[model samples]
Target: MKAKNGSMVAYDGEMAFKKLSGGGEGIRGMVTRRITGEQMTVMEVKGHGTCWFADRASEINLVGLQGDKLYVESSNFLAADAGLRTGTSFTGARGASQGNGLFTTTVEGHGQVAIMSDGPAVVLRVSAQYPLTVDPGAYVAHQGNLRQSFQSGVTFRTLLGEGGGEAFQIRFEGDGLVYVQPSERNTIAGDV
Candidate 1:
């Protein structure tokens, strides 16, 4: 399995941890990640009976992917099955607004992935009739076939500090599950 570097705290049986310079995506992926500023320090853990992983005592959520794609931020990523393919993808202005860079992490294949959040994550379902809007800072990860769009309610009123607290949000349509944390991170678009 691949986990965030230094996130392994305890394990039973035998385990070997090796630091991966660039998320174990190979030389080309390393260069691409470096140039895009979507860096992730990862480690490979093998021969583990029971491995415990944590990051700053953050809450963790388990997601099972059956040939689907999961889009998550590197900062919120904890671990994934070794068979899962990890890469980076463009997130456009959503990442810029959250101060998380222009690229997010992608995990695909039939395996389980672990994600972290400031608080317990709430899973919300989105469908053709039930689209959901999420605060960028509260979003953790999402899976299934979903279309994400960045929405900004910033207007002239925002200039005068009278904007809505949630002026920036990510709208999710199609069919999928969205993971959201109750707490919001300090983001550039938090107040407007």
Candidate 2:
């Protein structure tokens, strides 16, 4: 119904909810876990919605959920709902085997979902003039206002200091929002 200061609210029926809780004053969403079955904790992020886990996900089942408009960094997002398709860009991490990267897909209808690893997220405003550049691992979801493409100019090989282009990046242009996490994913020994 209402949020604290420094927070923006966007509601789309019960399918979408957004809480910009950070900066200046401080606004945290109300969260409550409501599941007592067998397995992990199923936290209902009040207006934040819910996240579904896939069998391949490591640590937690699913990550964060988005109602209205939300941003998620790479490490924070274990996996997102299959609703959005994978973008053509990817990047490899130090200890990563298959190259941990970012993906993008348009949310059908009038809503979308985002999963996160840690707590509340930070929302950044992106426009044509001031685009956003994020680490390959901290992105979660974005509004359908931007375009995803490989970085131009410097070749991947030159950027990675390798022989060829092994690392990849997503170039976001136009206008939209990006979600990022403060933490990177902790690699498990046998995660691959």
The candidate that wins on lDDT is 1
* Model 1 residue-pair collision total: 0
lDDT of 1 by residue, 1-192 (tens): 999999999999999999988899999889989998989999999994999998899999999999999999999999999999999999888898888998999999999999999889999999999999999999888888999999999999999999987899999999999999999988998867
- Runs in model 1 deviating more than 4 A are none
> Where is model 2 poorest over a 10-residue stretch in terms of lDDT?
29-38
lDDT tens digits by residue: candidate 2, 29-118: 111101111011112223444323332232232223344333332333333333332221222231132133222222322223434434
Cα-lDDT of candidate 1: 0.93
Pairs in clash, predicted candidate 1: none
Q: How far out, in Å, is residue 22 in model 2?
A: 36
In model 2, how large is the Cα lDDT of residue 146? 72
RMSD of each: 0.9, 14.0
